[model samples]
Target: MSDPVIICCAITGSVPRKSDNPAVPVTVAEQIESSHEAFEAGASIIHAHVRNDDETPTSDPDRFAALKEGLERHCPGVIVQLSTGGRSGAGRERGGMIPLRPDMCSLSVGSNNFPTRVYENPPDLVDWLSAEMAAHGVVPEIECFDLSHLFQAAALHADGRLPQRPYCQFVMGVRNAMPADRVAFDAMLTTKRHLFGDAPWCAAGIGRHQLELNEWAIAAGGHART
Candidate 1:
């Protein structure tokens, strides 16, 4: 029999406002409802980001607390992973929710280009964020937008900044970042095996490449992010 693979659902990201998609969940209550649905649909993890009443992203701790509480109550046993993505906030504000000690938090170890601007995760900030996660006992899911990020994650793990073996996530198909090329995907998988053998890994694709990346990750025996 085939083993079951974990599915992490990102219900709402920093981008994609209600104007873009009226169905996108923005408020805490709406997020909870959406998350419950995803959980019931076999998503074991919810990658969450809070938004303002006006549908703008915010790194508000209270918002995260409410979302975490609701997810725990409704989704029950689903992993809650707060995003530390740049679009939500800058510098230390991005890690504001780390103290909540969710099951996991997304950590990007390096800088990369987004669709319009640079997504920066400097070394000092990365170290600080990792340290905070370690202190709070929150496991990090390494977000590797570039191959270099994988090695950086390993280095952080080796130096004890990352207290545990992180769950690696390869992000592809961003306009100025890694493309969702089959050869690049294979190289990422090969490199992941060489660096962190048998450890859990997942793949994420932007926009139109989502399904393709999901298929590729599953066919290769890894996990998938939606």
Candidate 2:
């Protein structure tokens, strides 16, 4: 029997805009349509970030609700994962949509340097987000931008904060964060295995390394995110 691979599609990120590609969905309606297309193309998970009418990212729960509603109506059983990412909001505002109770949400357990600024996920905020996820029954997709984050996830799980063996996603090639290197990828896999044996995880490569990471992850018998 073939191993079943779960494909996760990030419909619209907070940083990209329609101006960047004319195809980047800025409105909720466009995002729902894009998600439906990806679902038809075999994506079982939809990772989304809501936006304002002016194309700026927002942590508006209303917008999240509308998008969640549309995705449920159009895509049925596909998992809907909302972004509690920093670009969309600051502090607790990022997790404001957690109450909407999507199947999962992105949780950054540590801070890392981005291209121009610090992607600050302070310990207190991380604790808050984790607590919120626990309260609302939202599973967290641990976004590990650096190697320390992998350990952090393990610690969180051990302490009962994460509740489950984490479904970690190694995020690579993000400017000042961990780069897209084969050695680093191998180390991540090794640590994941040590921490959670045979558990499912995923990898994501930014910019030009995206397809490469996808191939590497698949060959390694893990999951890939595009």
lDDT of residue 197 for candidate 1: 92
Model 1 clashing-pair count = 0
TM-score of 1: 0.98
As a TM-score, model 2 comes out at 0.98
lDDT of each residue in 175-214, candidate 1, tens digit only: 9999999999998999999888988899999899999999
lDDT of 2 by residue, 75-175 (tens): 99999999999999999999999999999999999999999999999999999999999999999999999999989999999999999899999999999
Q: What is the lDDT of candidate 2?
A: 0.94
Clashes of each: 0, 0
